[model samples]
Target: MSTERPRIVIAGGGLAGLSLSLALKQALGDAIEVAMCDPALKRDPHGDKRAYAIAASARRMLETLHIWDAVADKAQPIRDMVITDSRLQDPVRPTFLTFAGEVEEGEPFAHMVAGGDLTAALVESCRNAGVALMPTSVETFSAHPGGIDVVTNGGGITLRACLLVAADGARSRLREQAGISWISWPYRQSAIVATILHARDHEGRAVEHFLPAGPFAILPLKPETLPDGRIQHRSSIVWTERSEEVPHLLDAHTEDLLDELERRFGLQLGELSFETKPQAFPLSFGVARRFTAERLALLGDAAHVIHPIAGQGLNLGLHDAAALAEIVVEALRLGRDPGSADVLDDYERARRADITAMGLMTDGLNRLFSNDALPVRLVRDLGLGLVDRMPGLKKFFIREAAGLAGGTAPRLLRGEAL
Candidate 1:
């Protein structure tokens, strides 16, 4: 019997790639050979100020892989979420919806974790699991009949793998090389992301204020305490604005920016101080025409991109990682080519519907809310009110947010073995 293990190469070492690496390592052990390469190995992960709202399903997967413990102290459980809608300067920002985010008693449906902290944990877990980490960027790759040849930029080293996965960001060179078409359109909106130190405690409450421009989210973070026994509160902001106005907002003086922020931020949290310089990103919605091509598969942003209005962008990518890892491991156990047409097809089929639905829903919501048109605003506010009144329906939406809406939840999602 041949003792050689089937090899898989993953490009991009962000959340999706790292999570997939850990999942494969836990499930397949030494039965499979895995390698991941990224150009960012030398950089410090702490520079990333963004945070993610990890769904329950994703939390379960991370726990199974033994990753959540390292980040537990930095993660804040979101006990409740409040949604309000009104004109930007309106006298009142009326609450249109509210969600008690615990799917079960004593457990939150989601938790807020800093992007830097999550990446650091995943990188360490990957290192300890014996997954080879190549610190060079992929220069190019060519797909052959049975495998792929990947060349790194720095050392020009050539490596081969039976399957190559792309977890690269929105502009994925590998996906482009594989000739996968993408349907995407810019929303003419952008978001300002930053961390803030506030005077009052958030108490695990997250707020989404819907103004004429877009959704402004204030997500609670773990508290910081001073030596004098005073607790300093913090929150992450995702403030959306008109695309044309983003540059001005980002370039304005610090105090000027704070003045604008205070307008939407209200006085609920008392005084606020910037913990990091604000960063802005243009918003867009996109999905690949097909998730798999030949021996290659797309995960995370390479597969789809959605508006941050729903906070499901990263969770969707995590879903892809979980699904693809499960399918690949099953194929290996069956003594089948993990990258074969049959296996790839099954992976695509499993992810397509869920991804497509999410993409459409996010696109629709962005279009529905990110405007000042009187008729549209009235209709959407009414819709929100209606959804708020439906108890069973609200619970269903909560489950969806918990990442438990669809059929046959994945094993890792259920905190079960593969």
Candidate 2:
């Protein structure tokens, strides 16, 4: 290996940013310098509550950072998934077109994780792995031919690396500072997320019901991971709706919200009640005009943000991190600048096909399901049914959805029993 190590500067302390910090340190050991900046730390969010379903692929990434063990108790592995296209009148009988395979041997594709727990785990991992975490947000950033200069309220820190990663999230100020334009489309809807206590066991299975308005994802909460290290049962729900309808729904009381949820959710699990008041986030699809510019590179939401219908938001970003870290590690070994133009091009090439395909698929799904177009619904339901029947094809869907379809797969994601 080359005797030289690049200094890495990461913006945003969220999943993607914090993750890069640890992954770099783990791979480089004491060779490279890694620094990350974020607003407040952890889940000290002054914003609304949100969560994501961590695919088995993503869990492996966290394991690589040593965060999975810390937060695994909070995750409920989705042994199976039941998908349906339900109607208001025929709510009891949701057409079960496609279901995931559970007895395939190894494990399910993904698991359920709360937003708070995930952030906390990442923060702890970053600290444990010795990745310097700057408890400051970026004031701005400027990329030059060699590296970039980043300014934060705490002070100015300049990192000269092979590249600068903008994992700062969808509204990434870093991308804008670098003059990267984004392609955006309004989704005309909002997702309402909250915790729920179901009368029956989820059996570690997730349910997605495609309604006229949008898709409803009910993820099972395996157990709670307490600050004191105790575990308990819990689960979270994500309900999507029209923009204008969210306010009215949020304005509803707990009972009303539960009633509304039950109407759309049906009696799959039975007697579901809200454990937390619903929170709403406007949904949209956005992708940067370019994944890289000069010495600057983008990952995660900063690179692209799509409808959450598939719940790959974080998984996509984490995979981007994994891909990038691998590329940089290999480049440095060859005595190449990690941020060099050629190196950056290779990173984009490895990820672009998969990223663009997923974005388009999600965006198309969202648009196709948002309305009650008879023809569209008919076609979609038929498609789901076909997949259900095609066991060979279902396995492919599971593996792809689970993020297990990469040849240069990251270490943790290989499910190597981390």
In model 1, what are the clashing residue pairs, if there are any? none
**Candidate 1 residues 306-394, lDDT tens each?**
99988999999888989999999898888888888889999999999999899888888877787788888889899999999998999
Each model's lDDT:
0.89, 0.77
Measure candidate 2: CA RMSD: 3.2
Report how far off residue 374 is in candidate 2 (Å).
Answer: 2.3
lDDT of 2: 0.77
Q: What is the C-alpha RMSD of each candidate to the true structure, in Å?
A: 1.3, 3.2
Clashing pairs in 2: 56-110, 162-339, 221-234, 221-235, 224-232
